[model samples]
Target: MKQTIEQLADVELTENMLKIAKRELREDKCSREQSLEQMRNWVLKHEDLRNVRLDDQFLLRFLRCKKFSVPMAQQTLLKYLNVRRTFPHMSTQLDFLDQKLNDIISSGYIFASPNRDKHGRRVVVINAKGFNPKIYNSSDQARAHFLTYECLMEDQATQICGLVHVGDFSGVTTTHVTNWNPTEFARVFKWSEQSLPLRHKEIHLVNVPATLKWLIDFVKGRVSSKIRNRLTLYTQDKELAKHVDPACLPQELGGQMPLKAIVELWKAELLAKRETILNLDKIALLSDRGILRKSNYSSEKSSNGMNFVSQIESIEGSFRKLEFD
Candidate 1:
């Protein structure tokens, strides 16, 4: 059983997981090979996405996240690369061994739970207290987050089951809130919502300081209704556990395993995938030649510029009204 779970990324489909994938993601085993071929052909022909990874495992992540819709997967792939191009500081040349990043991981600021939730989603925790603004800037934090997400997405179980993010803001100070550039924050938020191939099942913010409420509201207003609906706020860990099982959480947040132990395990996982993460630097867009195809996806256009905040706010008001009504 353990070996089977370990081999899932090698396209070893489990009957039970296949059923879930079929029901939830429209993934049909009978047609999966055909679908993969179609996605591969489209990517190969895309003039803009140069040097994109073409392996079945890499392509399957986008396909599964888009529910096997080829066109959606294409758009997502483009957006993902575009994000890397736009935010070179955050995404490119991601070195896990860098002392600053290593220290951040060692502090256990952000990590995915080794255990899956009741609904089979991976639980990712972000303890704001672990961060020291004096030592590292927001870009370092973003890099750490990018590295963690890239590593986690390599898992087939994570790709299919999705992720639940828990933001532990217990010790978050006013300085932490002020450190972020609003435009950069909005752009990153937009990319997470639209570009990333991973499914976001839920986002729970716990022990949030009053200082961050405005920022939370800002995020709620900008994200899609699906994300907004999945967003939940908790005043205490007890309340958070009601939604995310305590068994999946680290000991610091009322779980069984020690936080240090979880961080150590996660560090080892990162080390194992060091080459895979480093290879991300090779994926580049053919933007200089102007051969990149423009996406009709709204977020694709919104991902650029200082005007994102105003643009989202203007659109979100009407979007929310239509969604709520």
Candidate 2:
């Protein structure tokens, strides 16, 4: 039998947390049962969706992300499937044991802290310098990021409290900037803001070089105002500590444990959930069913919507400056 969310390890759904979930996400215990049933039934009834996970725990992540709105949850779920289908290269063969992915994890390119911030949000750290563009292409880096976030989202706490992103862009060079094209950047940003069922509470970019500062402004234009408002840039690690609790960060960022230790711990966590992560491919969308004939799934606006593709595409001319200059 599949484990209930509460039964899962590392889940601490306390009374106070439940109250916060209700207050913030409208996740009432009584009504959520019905919502879950509705979401499950909706997926089952949809002819385009196949091999979708019907478990309560799996469905609840979508429901909570959409504030328990069945229609919004359904739309996000479809986008979630469509994204994987659309970007088969980045989404497929997500085996943790694969040498390329394993190298990325071992290099500590991206990983979620095993600890949570004071607000109970998970802290996902991305070290841009760790990524060697020569060894691994943009897709490899994207796959590593995709795999890490997928593992983190399994915890109910993450779904309820949301995530705090701390990106360390120190040591970034021209190679890093040139590695990812504008379309790739736009697609990933749009998907994260619209399609992914993730509550991104805060984003902190530290040690940003003057050259890369333009990239920050570029990203702000792509995401929602809420996320943009929450986004912060820091010139130093100490400035970051003023906002995020030091205990929540790794020692490299002024936390207790060394970043290396934290990366090892995160690797173990991913290894433990290898099968679960690999099985994410099972949640498929049927192409012949005519559901995903649209030009771009990420471009399609949801009920609570914005046309991020157009927003991103409109700025493509400006984005292409990287190629020319």
Candidate number achieving the greatest lDDT relative to the actual structure? 2
Native-structure RMSD, model 2 = 4.1
Backbone clash pairs for candidate 2 read: none
- Over 1-325, each residue of candidate 1 has an lDDT whose tens digit, in order, gives 1122225635644456667787998876555676788977887887777677877678878888998887778777877887888888988777889998999999999998887776777899999988998789989999999999999888787788889999998877655655566556777877766888989999999987665576588678668899999999998888887888887899877787899998988899899999998998888887634324464334344445435556655544333332110
| Backbone clashes in model 2 | 0
Task: Report the C-alpha lDDT of model 2 over 203-276, residue by residue, as the tens digit.
Answer: 99999877667768867765679999999999899899888877778888877888898999999999998998
Error in Å for residue 282 of model 2 = 1.4
Clashes of each: 0, 0
List candidate 1 segments past 4 Å from native. Answer: 1-14, 288-325
Reference-based TM-score of each model: 0.86, 0.88
Q: What is the C-alpha lDDT of each candidate?
A: 0.78, 0.80
Number of colliding residue pairs in model 1: 0
Candidate 1, residue 249: the lDDT equals 92
